[model samples]
Target chain A: MKKLYSTKYFKNKNNKHAEASLKKRLRFKKNKKKRNKIQNARTKPQKRVVNNKNKHFDYFKSKAPGNFSFLTHPIEVIEFISTLKSHFDKKRKVFILMNKIKSIDYSAIVILLSIMVKFKEKKVEFNGDFPSDDNINNILIASGFFQTLFKISFKTRERYNIGTHNAIHTHAWKDVDAELGANIMDNVSKMILGHKVIYKGLQRSLVELMQNSFNHATPTKEGEKHWWLSVNVNEKQKIASFSFIDYGVGIFESLNSKKEGSKFFNWKILMNLFSSENNADVLRKILNGDLHKTVTGKHYRGKGLPGIKEAMDRNLISNLHIITNNVFANVGLDKYELLPNNFEGTFVYFEINAQTSSTPWTELQ
Target chain B: MDRITVKIARDFSRTPGPRYIKEGKWSGEQFRTEKFYSIFDDAIKNDKIVVVDLDGTLGYGTSFLEEIFGGLIREHHLDYNQILNHLELISNEEPYLMTDIFAYLKDAHEESLVDNH
Candidate 1:
């Protein structure tokens, strides 16, 4: 019975062999696909580091004085400036490349301004081709350098047409050039020496204010923070103005969120918060007759405003104006005063005395 | 029998500033204050040797420290020897030691004068 049951052992063996072959073919196909993927990856060309080096060297060589180039990173701009300083014999003829500059932090501005100031001190002929936009120009003016270095004048209707488009414009032996890739090496060299001390105090103050904007006012989501800063030097008055502006949530909104009562919304309450000893440590310090010591902690502790006040007092700057939420505060030699303005957001404007013939570094111990 | 009891208001060893603590080890300020106060309270309650070492633990302003310690000394009626003994154990600086000693002594002296009146 066993011998005669099916009578097809060879056929069954062939079927099993066929199935094994099919499985082997599938495994081979999968392995071949993986191998091809790895080979493709191996053959992919990486960007050559030597090509970048050549491009970087070529960039400085081709840079023109007082012209702007398409540089996104601050490090690149700084490197380009270093190259220019090494190559150029005349330090004064160099101008900044700022037209394509999309964003700048306080530290960068401080470094750039320090370079400009050093160039002027060395009797170098320097001019900057800043963005022609009013906001941009004003920012530069406010940065405390615009008034200290360059003589600014509005172009008349006829001269405006020619000067606006031209890469270089001359007025009274002063040449304001376009944003050409220029040799900023001399400026960069001088700046590297002086920028550290100058920027420390400046950045500390700006960072405090900027942090206030970030934490209190326009609270930005993880990646949505937007702000602008500009600096300009006035050659005639020997004054410099640094200005910063942000489009985030304003001071009023911040205060309003933390407010408990209707009375807290008033301007007087806001002013008191800015200049009061309400917190426990601050109150204790005030009671202990330590007005100069700033109260600091996790929720709120900043010597920032106090530091700014100290800096202003030390410098003996004549004009200090703080504008926010359509209210303007002016602190002068004689008195403190306030005025209303249509402009919104916070604006801090100070006239840095250029004729004093002293840089911030000179005052630092 | 005279027992020298020092009631410390805060644990000098445990309390750390905001900058010192990582987020994973983040203990809130309230928790830190409680730990400090509890350690000090326990030290004071026990009739053991109480040591107040403000070597690196003085994170808050001098006034805050004064308010806290001033109130503690007044409440406990801590003697000059007790305060000095604590100071000697902590640091040998004159200005800080003298200032704190004078503050406590001045208050004690003033209270004595008021009692006399």
Candidate 2:
């Protein structure tokens, strides 16, 4: 009886000890979890807040020149964007500063829009601040830049009195959207002529450019490539400037890239020649239709670019400038020069004025 | 012989698209397969002339035009000369288009000959 009592008492004492140790371990686990929560909070990245005051971030600054324009300051603009793209490739968060910019144009705005859209698609974090100058800020807002960035509608433009500025707005499309093309032409005609007339030349030019992007912009499948277009109309001057941009394999590289399901081989010989030349000579030859037959081996193909050239020649459009790859050509001045820095895509700017011809709209039969 | 007229804008699309249907809606290939091919076949079979009115549409891409007119010869195996004989184009909006169509037809014919040889 004595032995049984003593054994039972000792067993109860051991159970009590184990219970106290379990409680102590539970307390340790709770403290560790709380500590981990604090650690994770400290390590996590902060969310970007896009507000009017524009909060500062630990971001690399992509500085713009005083004159932020492709037309006036081609080298500076291209080099800035080229470096910006390199920054994007590195997945670095960027803050594009236009505060120093005194003057800007729609051409540069459209190109920047394309780059920003690409950055968004790639999920590379970027923020842009408007110029400190009120006029430049208003121009940026009127050009539809802030609207696109902020996901605001035309109401923003109304608030800013966008009509005071010549920039009609900027737009983009991912595929060959013909209906949109027609609608744009209709609006252009309405803006320029004060009536809806079918501007066939401009419509065709726009469609051809869109089609080119759809087909040749990316090595990927169709509908994957994107094109941006912007229009600036000076009503009193009776002139409308159109800018089209596509960041793709470009005109020169497009010829060499293997097309989807195409039986023909890549243009090895032409690519070699294209590499050696100043690229201006190559662009001139391309505009003249000399390389099309040789590269494509199809007489039916390569008419689109030449067709645009023809429209320009016929005075349907004027002051045409083409920048593709490294070559920038003021086609009207018959001047083609190689840029010190390369632009990896195509930028086409043209204008239509009172001198431009149009096809009168007929009642649908 | 019946004069079969195909008004592109009224019958097919006011905004004709790029070459292939895979590219977008209302594509030239779609037009060729869905609209123009049967008319072309009927014209060939019945000794009728097919008059294509090219006005009223926004415009034509070179690819769109080539895919339809040149595609008749290249894709349908129709002789270019025979197709031209039966085809008449009316492009009041852009007369230059008619010239472009002619060039495409000749080029397609030449390509076909090269393939055969």
Candidate 3:
């Protein structure tokens, strides 16, 4: 349905209009929020947490071998939290045993922090001796996990500075401002993309991830929900890697867990479709914005997941990968695998090749 | 024959987007629906033909545009056709933006008809 008279056809008319309208259009909305935020900033506000110094609880009596490498074992970390729930429900004192932790990774950090946040919300007294491995301990502390959760100020740490390196890590054990993705872009862009700014598509995708982690991913225990984000750079390889983990119901699990989930499948069955459907197909469909039909009865939801494919389709990002529940898929690697055991929650990682994506990203703006 | 204009980057945060953050924020968060619509309403009340400059800003979110443009119909209770008659967007940089905005208006139109969105 192309119109006979196009805007381009009326360029002269449009310019004449533009010239006349230039001075009339008010720049009204731009500074309103900034002014309000500044006005509020003038008043000193109290800390967001209520820390209990007197009560202390031991988390685990046994040596905790929990680390990223250990977490990759077939066991579900959410179930581990379930084992601690009855004990947590019975006592106010909770202590975690990290002394036995010989190895750890990003996934391990997310799981530990998420579990701790859940317990913290229960008003249980909690503390733990640092893992004996100095490297592991330093990584955890630099990640802003403890400070962000407990409201402690560690001014001596390099975490306060932005230019220290190309790596970014933040664990939100509690609710937080939308700072992680923006901060990651600010810190890593100079070294990686030659700019100190974030791409709009990536920012939207990141914000959606954070929002979903908090909004729908109910914790195994009612009080705990957390998300961990990390972006590491390989300068020689000229690539950056991002890892985001949230322990909640995975996308298919979330959608299918509802009654609509079964109804959609039943419809598929009647239509002689969905014979080979698994989490991989479901994951792909979700990312392509094709799952709208299943959700139309509920509401126009599921717009966020497809943004990854949209960003990739628009060449905003590459090497997009995800593992949620029992499926593993990487768009760049051309892999969409369904593994043997369900991964429980979701784990996502992607690469930003500096050479191919060095331009200042502006598609989002 | 002349149109009214609103230069977003000149008056708002150059990278206008969402309004989730509330404190110690340096960037302006004027991307809210109420904020944008109030300005729109003033122009509408004056019976002025308006052109919104969607250029110069860092980028626009689907949610941001949907909330403001679709919300003109949804929250402000303005008719979509009525708003379209008076409102024109300047998205010369991304012609596809006009399409996106119209899709939101269409969704809002459907919702207004049956409250289905």
State which candidate has the highest lDDT.
Answer: 2
Error of 2 at B75 (Å): 1.3
The per-residue C-alpha lDDT of model 3 at residue A16 equals: 80
What lDDT score is found at residue A148 in candidate 1? 56
Ranking by DockQ: 2, 3, 1
| lDDT by residue for model 2 (B1-117), tens | 789999999999888988898777788999999989989988998899999999999777788998999899899999787898899999887787888788888988998998999
Stretches > 4 Å off in candidate 2 = A1-54, A151-167, A258-276, A294-302
Ranking by lDDT: 2, 3, 1
For model 1, how big is the iRMS in angstroms? Answer: 17.6
User: Which regions in candidate 3 have their CA more than 4 angstroms from the true location?
Assistant: A1-108, A116-167, A171-180, A219-224, A234-238, A257-276, A293-302, A356-365, B7-33, B45-47, B55-61, B90-96, B115-117
**A15-81, model 1: which lDDT tens digit per residue?**
8999999999999999999977765665222123223334444232223222221112323433444
Rank candidates, TM-score, best first. Answer: 2, 3, 1
Clashing pairs in 2: none
lDDT tens per residue, model 3, A261-315: 3434444434344767766776776676556545454333324566556666665
For model 2, what is the error of residue A190's alpha carbon versus the real structure, in angstroms, after optimal superposition?
2.1
Assess the local accuracy of residue A320 in candidate 3 as a C-alpha lDDT between 0 and 100. Answer: 75
Residue A361 lDDT in model 2?
81
Per-residue lDDT of A276-309 in model 2, one digit per residue for the tens?
6767987787776666766766542436676677
Give the number of the best model, judged by TM-score. 2
